[model samples]
Target: MAGAGPVVFAAAGVATLAAALLPRVLSRAPISMPMVFLAAGALTFTVVEPLPDPNPVTHSSIVLRLTELCVIISLMGAGLALNRPVGWRRWSTTWRLLGITMPLSMLAVALLGWTVLGFGAAGAVLLAAALAPTDPVLATEVQVAEPVEDPEDDSDDEARFALTSEAGLNDGLAFPFTYLAIALATTPGDWLPHWLAVDVVWRLAAGLLVGLGAGWLLRKLFFNAPSKTFRLAHHAEGFVALAATFLAYGVAELAHGYGFVAVFVCACTIRAGERTSGYHRVLHQYVEQVERLLTVLIIFLLGGAVATGLFAGVQWREVVVALLVLLVVRPFAGLIGLARGRTGPRERVVVSFFGVRGVGSVFYVAYALEAGHFLEAGAVWRVVGLAVVGSIVLHGITATPVMRFLDRKREVLTSP
Candidate 1:
């Protein structure tokens, strides 16, 4: 206990080891890896007197960078894991979730923040945008797995396909609104024109163009480079995934586009290039491992923050709104959006209820607070923190059982 530094390192090593094992250990049970890490963080921070308070308000930059790294890595993993082709009909459920469910959820949350929580328009929209994306990090159980022999049938499981694709794209798509919140907060009156042109039109276009372009080039290098030594895919190194993530994001940000969008798009484009290659599996496994480690650290810190009074000023309204956002708003909006879509009733219900919000929400709030003015920054943190905690606990408990039940039901119904 004399040197707190060594204790922290030892804790991290043990936590990483648990991260490697928990998914297999808790595969059938109601418990999840996130739940374990959260509880560990809470308990650790509560008992450890030397540990610094994990406060986001005082440490905005650290939170922003940490969450940003976690999210982009997750987006890359989500993109690479999907086996489905990119087509309107093939991804109908995903499109519905992004285009319809996302907006509806955002509007609903924004309205609640305004009327119930008394946030200004900008603050309301910021809160909504922060919590909008179904996190790619914590929802891995519901997403598609690594590449398989048949690319076309990669995601034959409809629920996995829907959740996977939805998580991949919505993180990037949510950026426009987050920027809109920033615009409204900083400039007030004269922000609309620039926002519409740059945030809406230009950023979207650039992110897509850059992501697709970079992915295509990377795929070429990986699979078809002139020299055998130059073809990285032949080497089968997993670190290329990190290289690809950083490249796509750095290029997109330099071009004034959304790096979140570009990273996912780049990953998907990479997948599209080599659908059946075993190299993708190697890359995906590595990325998944890294993501799991980061998830453990972030969620543990989140629990620590909560234990250290992150929710101290949270009111009844904030608590109720957080509950409504997770329970009522997302479910109803997802149901409405997926209505009459290809999913069966059971699948629809699963997809609707599993809109898991996590680290991405934290990242957005930190990003927004850093960029613009929000007087009620503490309140925003408390609200978003509570919402994230509720989501991790509720969805974490339900994901395994519900997904297993659906899988069983599908097998029975499809038996000849």
Candidate 2:
């Protein structure tokens, strides 16, 4: 046991180094950093003896909280990275993707879950709601980087920018649907009025109001304080990103609002506060590093969870549903939503192709289960696992090549 201590310490050191170096090394590769760690986790558990189990069912609260942290941190990064100001016409792609594509995808998934996977109403709803949004965490490579000076060149293209913005905002937007699943689970078959009152009307409204209010207040503190001592931007304190995330999330939840929605909205409002300041870059860098660390931990645990047979009770039908979500449902929904939008063929294809699933899905599933009762919990787990795995593998492999091709095409067209 004394000798084991050094080995463990050495392993930790090596893992940290790998985490730091892997992103740069894999930037040009066909694989992703998440895939590498996920594979490592599965292998480590399979080979190592007496390793601690990390199943989600056994450690639900821990999984929920860790993923919750990952998402909110990523939200802050997403907000800071966007150079584009928030306006109806400027963010038209974001608006269209959020308003049109997201709901269509949800409805399609829910229907498929019901008809194909034999899920009950509550389970189907939970699955659909969970899978509805694009992941803000895993899709970072394809997303826009930190605020660029030139607004015209800020994003890769309209399609990628739109997808990133949509993913960032909709991570919060999907909360109402999760709430609906919870309501269906608790209610005795007549949940329309309550769903309308709480899920649709009250919670959404409260979330928006709280987010706007909290964001406005925080923006003032960060950007313009009464005194220099209280002004966070003056000191360039980046850790406040986490502070804002938790503050917005806690306040909104306390007020019976969707904390997720509040977090993103708060981030957007904060970003809008100091659009051209170098302080925004400082804050974004700090939040991004923190988010990356959190992501590593979560993905490592997810790998551990898989080794412990997280998908043990998944059925063939559920597997089919999962595949359908990644391969059929999301792509088609994206295509339809962006039909009359600004993207060209290559851009549209890339946007539709990379609807990768990650921590958000985990949060939704856990939140739904905690709030509701599903008959086929095992099956739900199975389907979600399959979908996540498929997304990780498929999207991870194609992201680099697809992005490269698109970039090349854009260069050729714009060079003349």
TM-score of each: 0.98, 0.95
Query: Candidate 2 at 242: error in angstroms?
Result: 1.1
lDDT of 1 by residue, 1-416 (tens): 57777887888789988998999999999988999999999998998897887888889999999999999999999988888888999899999999899999999999999999899988999999988899999998787877775765643688888988898888888889989999888889888889999998999988998899999999999998999998999999998999999999999999999888899999989988877788888889999999998999899999899899898867999999999999999999999999999999999989999999999999999999999988768889999999899999999899889988988898898799
**Residue clash pairs of candidate 2:** none
Q: Which of the numbered candidates is closest to the native, going by highest lDDT?
A: 1
**Each model's total of backbone clashes:** 0, 0
Local distance difference test, candidate 1: 0.90
Give lDDT: candidate 1, residue 312.
Answer: 85
Best by TM-score: 1
